[model samples]
Target: MERGTRTPGAFAGALILALLLGGLFPALLASGAGGTPAALAVCVLVLVGARLGWLIGIGERRLMEFSFWTFTYVFLGLAALVQFQTATFSTSTPWFDTAYNDDAMWAVLIGSSAAMLGIRLAARGPTADAPARTPLVDERRIHHLAALGLLLNLYYLIRVGPGTVLLTREELWAAQVARWPGNGLTAFVVAVFTLPLLVVFIGLLGVNRQRTDRGEPPRYALLAVVGCVLLFSVNPISSPRYYSGTVILSMAAALGAYATPWRVRASASAFLAGLTLLFPLADAFRRQGGVETRFAPLQALTSGDFDAVIQISNSVDIIARNGIEWGWQLLGVPLFWVPRDRWSEKPAATGSYIAEQMGYPFTNISSPLIAEFLINGGWPLLIVGMFGFGWWVRRRDDRMVQIGLLGGKPSGMDWILPFYLIILLRGSLLSAALQFSVLWAASWFIRGRRSAGSEGAAVPGRTGAHGGSILTHQTSG
Candidate 1:
C-alpha cells in the first residue's frame, strides 16, 4: 500500500531472481572448455546478468514490474526467432526475403509483449487491486504537447520535402502498399517513419480525457505503432534502418499499460499488439514477388562501390551481421578468421572488426566491453572514457533525461515528430546522454544547496516525479 511497493506476480519474480544470482558460478565453471565453450559461457553470463538485474532490480526504478513485461518480451522474441526459423516457407522469394513472415514474427512479438505486459492486469483474479498513484495528464496538456509535436513533424517534412519523388510517386506507393517488400517502397517507409512522432503527439491528445470529452478524437495513437511496423516491413530504407518502430511501440505499450491498472492495460496491450501486427502479416501473404537483393551489399563491395559498400556495411552492422559476406576483404584479418567469405552475424561489430584487424580472430566477449576496448582506446581507456562521458552527461540537465525517457515533452505526442528530428540529426542524439547529464546536475545541484534549507531542496514538483511511483518507467529500449 505504501508508495512504490509491488505485489509479486506469478513465479517469474522468484525464478528470475534465482537464475540471475545462481547462473554465474556454473557459467564460469565451464569456461576454457573450447572455442564455442567461451561463447556459450558468455551467453550464460549475459542471460544470467539480465535475469539477475531483473531480480536485483537494476537500471530503472520499476524494474520488477517491468521485468514481467521483459520476460514476456523475451518470449515474443523467441516467437520471432521461431518465425525466422520457419522463414523457409518464404525463403525462395528473394534475399532471404521474408517480409511477410518477419511482419508476422514482429506482430507475434508485439502482440505477445503487449499481452504479457497486461498480465498483472489480467490476474486481478477476483477483485480489482486498488488503483496505484499513476500520473494523470490533463487533456489540455496532452493536446498542447501533441500539437507541438505535430507542428514540429510538419515543419521537418516541409524542410526536407518529399525525398526523391520518383521514390514515392502515388502509383508506386500504392503498389508498394499492396506488397511492402518492393523496392519502390523504400522512400515511403522512411517518410512514414517520420509520422510516429506526429502520431505520438496526436495519439497522446486522443488518449487524454480533455480531447475525448469534447468528442473522442479517433484513436490515432494506435496508428503510430502500425505505421512503424509497415515502414520496418519495407526492409530497404537506409535512414533509420532497422525499423525500430516496433521497439518504440513496445516501449509505449509498456508505459501505457503501466499508467493504468493491470487488467485494463493488459487488455489494451493485447488489442493494440494484435492491431499493430495485422498489416505486416497481411503484407507477407501478398508478397509473392519474393526477395532478390540479399546479396546487394556483396555485389557493391566486390564492384569496388565504396559508397554502396559503406552503406551496406553499416546496415549489416546494425543487424549485427559480422563481416561474413566480405570474405576475402577480411582475408588475413584476425577477427575475420572464419573464412574470407563467411559472414559473422552478431551485434557489436566494433569488437568483431577489431579482432580481425588486430589478428585476434573474432570471438565474442562479454557485453560491449570488447567494442569499448577496441574503440576510443582499448579496455583501460574504455573504462575511463565511458565513465567520464557518463559522468559528464549525468551532470548536465533534467531536460535531457526527460527527453530520453518520454521525449522532451512526450506526455501527449507521437514518435514521428521526434523520430524525424532524430533523422535530421543523423541519429547523433542520445537520450541516455541527456538522462546522465540531468541526473549528475541534479545530484550536484541538490548536494550544494542542501545546507541552504529550502533553497537547496528539490522544488517539490521535480524530485522523484518519475520515481516513488508504482506505475513509473524510467528506461525503455
Candidate 2:
C-alpha cells in the first residue's frame, strides 16, 4: 500500500521536471540570456534538478532534508530562471555591472549547486563525532519559559494593543517606532508572541507517550491551547511568510506529518507548489493596507517577490568591486549579542550592508546563504562552508531517521531544528543570530533544568546538546 501510494507522486515529479527542462528550458535558451547558454543551462538544471531529486526520494527524506532542497529550488532557482531569461538584474545599480553580468548569475548558481553536492556528501561521510541531537524536556522549566513569554507578550499587546499587531506592516512598523520601549528588542517582542511553540511539542510528547505505552484515548486540550495562543499572536497580516511558515510547519511535524516516506514527498511537493503559487499572494497584505495583488505567480516572480537570486547577485557585484571580506563580515553573526557601541567597527547585517553599498533606498532585502558565503571569502569559503553545512544537515537528518527506526519520538530541539533551518538557510546570518542563540540557550537551559532535577543522580537526555544517550527523550509533566 505504501509503495503504491508513492507511484503517482513519482510520475507527477517526472512530469513537472519534463515541463520545466523540456518546455521552459527551450524558451529560456531562445531568450537574450542565450548569450551565455552554458551558464544558463547549469543554473536551470542545478536548481530544478534539486527539486526533482528530492521528490523522487533520494537519501533519507527527513523534513529538514526536504526543506534544504525545496527552499533552494524555489527561493533561488526560480529567481535565477527569471533573471537569466530576461537578461535583467534586480540590483538596479550600474555600480558593479562593469563586470559581464553572467558572472553574478554564475556565482549564485555555483554556490547553490555546490551546497547540493555538499549535502550529498553526507551519505559517504564519516560517522558523526557526537549524537546529532539531544532531546530533553523539562516540563517545569518550559512552563516557566512559556509563562515568561506570555508576560512579555501580554505587556507588548497591552502597550501596542492587539490592533497594532494585526494591522498592516506599515502600521506595525509605526507602532514599533512609537511604542516599543527600547531599541534592538523588536525581535524579542515577536519571539515572545510565538512562545506557545516551545510548549506544543512537549504537550505532544506527553500525549504520544501515553498513547504508545498505555493506548489511552488522545487528548486535544493541550494542542487546543497551543493553537489559540499562536493564532492570537501570529497571523499573515503581521508576521513575515517565513516566520508563519516555520510555526505552521513545526506544528505539523510535531503532529507527526513526516512519519512516512510518501508523506515526506507529498509535503515537499506542497511546499514547492505553495511557494511558487501562493507565497506571493500571501504577501498582498504585507505593507499595503489590504490585499492588492492577484494570484499572478509568474508576474510576481518577474516583478520582485523572489529576491534571493538577485540579492546573491548583488553580493557578487560587491565582490567584483571590493573583493571578498575574507571572513570579516561574518564576525558579527556569532557575536551578534555585542552592541555596535562597544565594537565600533562591527559589520552590519549582510543584507542591510549590501543594500547600503548598492545605494538601494531600502535596506531590508534578502542576502541568501549563497550570497553570505560568497561575500565572506568568495569561492574558497563558498565551497568549504556549503560542504560543511550540507554535511551537518545530513547528520541531523540521519539522527532523525535513527530515532524513527527505534520507535522513539523527538520532543525537543531535534523536533524544532528542521523548521529552524528554514530561517538559517534563508540567511544574512546576523538576521537569524538572535533566534539561533535563543534556541541554543533554551536547549542548554532545559538540559540544566533536567540535570538539576536528577542531580548527581542522573544524566539528562544523555549523549547530548553539546553527551550520554539518545535512547530516552525524557519528558515529564
Candidate 3:
C-alpha cells in the first residue's frame, strides 16, 4: 500500500497486534518463561517485534506509533484483568487462570471493534495542517522548570518511599524467580514513547541530522527535554509507569505536531482517537461479569492481598466505567445504578487490597493535578484550573492554526489532545488543564496578531498597521 493509504490498514493491524501482544502473548510467554527475568525480556522483544512488523506491513508511521501507545494502555488494563480473574479461580503460583478467558476474548474483540470503527472514520479524510515548528521552549526555561519539578518529585519520593513506593526492581525480583513478566512491557513502552522526540529534536539542531529547511531557524529543543524530564521526575502517586508513557507520548505528539504537515496531523489525530476508544468501551462490557477477580498476580507479586491491587485498578477501571456509565446513565438513575450494596461492596472489597498494591493515594490522589488540588485546595480548584488552562491552550492553538506553522489542516493542538487526555485522565485536572491552556493561548496570540494585521491591511489608508502598504502621497506637479 502507498504511504497515506496505509493509515487505515495500520489501524486495523494495530488492533490485531494489541490482541496478540497483550492477550495471547502474555499467557503463552507465561507458560514458557516461567516468570523469569529472561521471560520478561523475551516478552518485550515479542511485543517490539510485533509492533515493528505492524509498522512494516501497514506502511504508516503514525498508525504504527498509535498502535504502540494503544497497546501500552490496553495491555496494562488486560494485565489487571488477568490478575483479577486469577484471584477467583485459584491461588496457585504463576496465577494464569482460564476463568476469565471468555471475558478476555470478548474484551479483545470489543476493543478491536472500537479501534476499527475509529480507524474507519479517521481513514476517510486527511488530518488538519501539520506544524512547522516543533514545540520548543527556551533552554534556560526548560532547565529551570525541570529543576523545580524534580525537587518536588524528589521530596515526595523521599516522604513516601519508606512506606509506599512500588520499586519495580525489588518488587519484580524474587528468590530465583520473577513475577509479572509484563513489567518489562511497561518499560519498553516507556522507552519507545519517550526516546523518539529527543532524537528528533537533537537531530533538528545542527548536531545529528542535516537541516533540509535551511531558511528555518533552529528552535529550542532543550525546553521540551527539560519539561519532559521534570514532569517524569515528579513522583506522581499514581501508576508512574503508565503515566510516564503518557508524558513521553505527549512530548512526542508535541514534537510531531510542530514538525509534521497539516494533513499528517489530521491522520495522526484520527488514528490515535480511533485506537484508544476500544478498551474503555470493551472494558465496560468486561466488568459486566458477576465478579471481578483480576488482582491475584499483583497480590502475589506484591505479596499483598486481592484488596490492594483491586483498589488501585478499581480507580482506573472506574475512570473508564464512570465516564461510560455516566455517558449512558444520563437517561435514568436506576439505569446506571447497580444495587447500592453491590456497588459499595464489590469494588471496595476487591479494590481495597488492590489499592494497597497500587500504592493508592500516590497513584490516584497524589498525581500532578490530583495531588495539587487535594493538598492545596479541593475539586473546585481542579475544575477552575483545568478550564483556565484549557481555554488558554485553545487560544494558542488558534495562532498555530493561523500561521500554518502547525502541521496539517487540523490545529497543532488537536494532534496532541490524546496525549494530553491520557496524562490528565487520572491526574489532577487543574494542572493539566492549566498547562494545555498556556499552550493553546500561545497559538492563539500568534493567530490573533496575524489576523489583526491582515484585517488592518485590508482597510484603505491603514498604513500605520504592521504590514500596510506605502504611505507616500502623490505629487500634483
Top candidate by TM-score:
2
Question: What TM value does model 1 have?
Answer: 0.36
lDDT of 3: 0.35
Candidate whose lDDT is highest? 2
Q: Report lDDT per candidate.
A: 0.31, 0.63, 0.35
Q: Where does candidate 2 clash, by residue pair?
A: 462-468, 462-469, 463-467, 463-468, 463-469, 464-467
Kindly list the per-residue Cα lDDT of model 2 for residues 1-477, writing each as its tens digit.
Answer: 112234555566656654664356535544445356335645555565544553435223466666776676666656556655665545433343424446555765666566667666665654343222234455566556656656766776777778887887677767766775444577765664564445444444544454554567665665576566676666667777777777677667666666676676566667768877877787787786557856756566654556666677678788878888988879998888887779999988898889898888877767778788889989788878877887777677665665564445555566667777777777778988887666566555554222222221222344534344433321100
Error of 2 at 347 (Å): 1.0
Clashes of each: 40, 6, 65
lDDT of 3 by residue, 237-287 (tens): 223333444444545554553343333435444443433342222222122
**TM-score of candidate 3 against the unseen true structure:** 0.37
Model 1: worst 10 consecutive residues (lDDT sum):
304-313
TM of each candidate vs. truth:
0.36, 0.81, 0.37
Off by over 4 Å in 2: 1-34, 37-60, 87-100, 129-136, 181-183, 193-196, 199-220, 447-477
Off by over 4 Å in 1: 1-4, 8-12, 15-33, 36-40, 43-207, 210-241, 244-255, 260-373, 385-477
Model 3: per-residue Cα lDDT at residue 94: 23
Q: Summarize candidate 1's per-residue lDDT along 1-477 as a digit string, tens digits.
A: 112443454234545544643354334434343333233323433443344334333222222233233322222222222222322211111132122233223222233333333332322222211112112334444444345445544544344343522232343344434544543243333333343343343334335433454585646553464334333333233222223333344345334433423433353334324422431232322222442333332122122111111221222332343323332222222332232236554222332443343343332211122122213232244334334432322222122223233322222222222222222111112211222232223222211111112121222223344453222222221
